[model samples]
Target: MPTFTTRKNKIVLTDYNYRRDIENRLFMAELSILEVDVLQEIINGSLKTTLTTLADNLEIAPSKLRPILDKLAKSGLFQIQGDGVLVDKEMRKYYEAHIIKFDDDFRPDMEYLQGLLSKAPIHALPSWYAIPRSSDNIFNSIIEKFLFTPKIYERYLQDLVFDNPIISSIAKQVFAAPDYKISASALIEKFGLTREQFEEYMLFLEFSLVCCLRYVKTNDVWEEVVTPFHEWHEFLLFVQNTHPVAIQDVTPITAVYEKEFGFLNELNAFVKKLLKKGVSFTNAPKDLLEVALLLEIAKQEKQKIVASVYTEDWLKKTRADQAIILYRQSLNRLIANEQFTSFSEKDLREVEKSLKNFAHGKWVYFEDYIKGCLAAVGSVLPTSLVNRGKRWKYSTPNYNEDEREFIKLITCEYLMQAGMVATGYHQDKLCLCLTPFGRLSLG
Candidate 1:
């Protein structure tokens, strides 16, 4: 029978043998590190520990440690009682009833026994642990070395690490096209990953490439850097030679690239421009607004707009002015729509007056005109109705003018609801426009 000597100098049947002697067997063959530690403590009569104590000892959060204990209990290794865990009474009785003996010099060889313990297959381990720790610490050492000595890494791994081909292909296509840029958020939407997972995968891929293939980090986000095809080819050859198993199963790498390339390609161009312009120049809100307006203009022109005019002088002279133009253009498009033609002359005049007021900085009157027009179009309810103004003297209650105006601009949903304006959708938001009665009054 297999046996283990406890730290207290008592010989006991191993969990496997004790379980077998009691005519019970584990359904699964492996336990996590925490489980192994907890089992050893239980056997040694030192199992009294709270969740916090376990977390402190294990260097993990109490919430994280609790799940590990729950898993052990669920797997029939122990019975959790109140705040403590106990050995399975039957298994313990079996151990006591059929005690095993070993040589006087027989000491528990933890390292050897742990090695003997059948662990989950490499593929079955969590990706965080499995991908880094497998193949006799190959990936782990590489990641450590790359993070610590980035300069040495650049010299050694640059030729071997390849640029992500998927992103490069997409970027080439985007750059080749006129007046178009990919949307980073749209690409993320396609993959449906949480922000954290996307970030983790990006970091993992970048570090892996840098250490194994000798890539350099040239951009704030590593994904934004341009990698040459020749470098990538050499990197693939290196991967094939150094880690045959990883090369054999390239599905993980491929999946990550396929999922993220659409967004990364667009972001790469944006980052390149931002870096060239310098941080102080690009950080201004006006500069950003100008970029947005230029992008919009480029969309209209069907041409790409380079950041050549992103200078301080350009921002001081033209950024805000261009934004105003774009805003005016947006309003003009709304007024020209077929639905607005049915508006009465008085209502059209009100809209024009509001547009002029907005141009001259009478922000409050401009807001009212925009809201009244939206109400006339049935896109949003009048601020009064949604705000329950009937009970109060003022049409807009509690909300300041700025707050009401902000809501109207953001939730204008003409493209939503099949291009029709609807009020119920926006709920209590001053987002709803006028009913038919209100529209007829404008006429």
Candidate 2:
């Protein structure tokens, strides 16, 4: 069992055991290639060897081998005494078999996905493979790394770690325990996350299938709390072990779709109910509107988008000016879609009256236009992450015209971060478009 305790401002590591099969509790510590080579030397024990002789056999300095031995020893594999590396008797058997699990040969089986998808119901397909394992379907290379071992290693930050750092950090802390248990308030306050934000992150985790609910006593009452999904830890470990890679490429960590995994499930439900009712973005719940652009990006079949003139600059403008920028983009897209035969300046005179409220932050109208972009997946009732300043309270984004563009700009940025749209500068314009999965969502 692994344990963690803070000692003099440093996290102390102890008893790091990989309990994939809780009963067996394999002492499977992550090791470097060199470390594995060193362990192999000791385990082979083919000839009587000292550090100097072993170093000669491996063609490396004895000094270099010392640290590798230390790391493995600290990881509970061996001990060093009187300049001789001592190995535990039982380890001779275990380490030899365990050695392959850490080698560079691990690859997620392409057939794993095929088997999983085949087992899934059409209604629950999103749950099985909403995110791709890799860019190419012929090989399951992408699915291999995207699993649990090394998400931070991937080029695209689609996994939870990059999508929402705070949430990912919380998940890490939750797992860094003998068992997946942690104090709730201490976690929130430790990271300076508002209660509402923590709750939002919890929902994101729940959707990812990384957490399940348990109860802990709080203020004399038992309360439901979030903890690591024990079942998943074992499964993820099994998946990675069977397809272990020594290390993944260095990928810069950035935020990506935190809510996206859950969004798919939620959107599926929302669409079923939404079609029966007349809910435009104006009256659409916050969660629905929050994810409104996801469908739009899906329709475009692009991962990123260039906002061009539709950026924060529009938010700082006067209400009428903000309307002009947003309304123009809407008009252009509508005209491109053949919604209008030939719109021009003369048409704007009449269109402006209808778009006046939309430009002034009648967000639902914008969402209504985006409806055609979605594949009718479910979405949850819209909600807010902004601290409402009261217990269980709700506040609309923009109650005044000046607040309209502010909300819109923020939404656009969020849509990009959530992988709904990847916003970037393309040819000196703000580009907005669908991502890979975003296009996949369309299918």
The number of the candidate with the highest TM-score is: 2
lDDT of 2 by residue, 1-443 (tens): 11212211111111122132121212232344566677777777743346777788889998897777676676444667757766677756655544543334422122222332332243343323343433454223323433323222222123333244676677677766444567656677889976556655554454343453334434644344455443334433433333212112212212233333333334334444443443444444455443434333111113322222223332344533322333335434334434333333343332222222222221122333222121111121122212223211111122233223322333344333333333333233332334443343222
RMSD of 2: 22.5
Q: Please report how far candidate 1 places residue 438 from its true position, in Å.
A: 99
lDDT of 1 at 213: 10
- lDDT by residue for model 1 over 163-247, one digit each (tens)? 3343223333322323222332333354564544333333323322321111122232211112212223232233233321112
Clashes of each: 15, 38
TM-score of 1: 0.17
The models' CA-based lDDT, in order, is 0.32, 0.40
For every model shown, what is its TM-score relative to the native structure?
A: 0.17, 0.23
Whole-model lDDT, model 1: 0.32
Each prediction's RMSD over C-alphas, in Å, is 27.5, 22.5
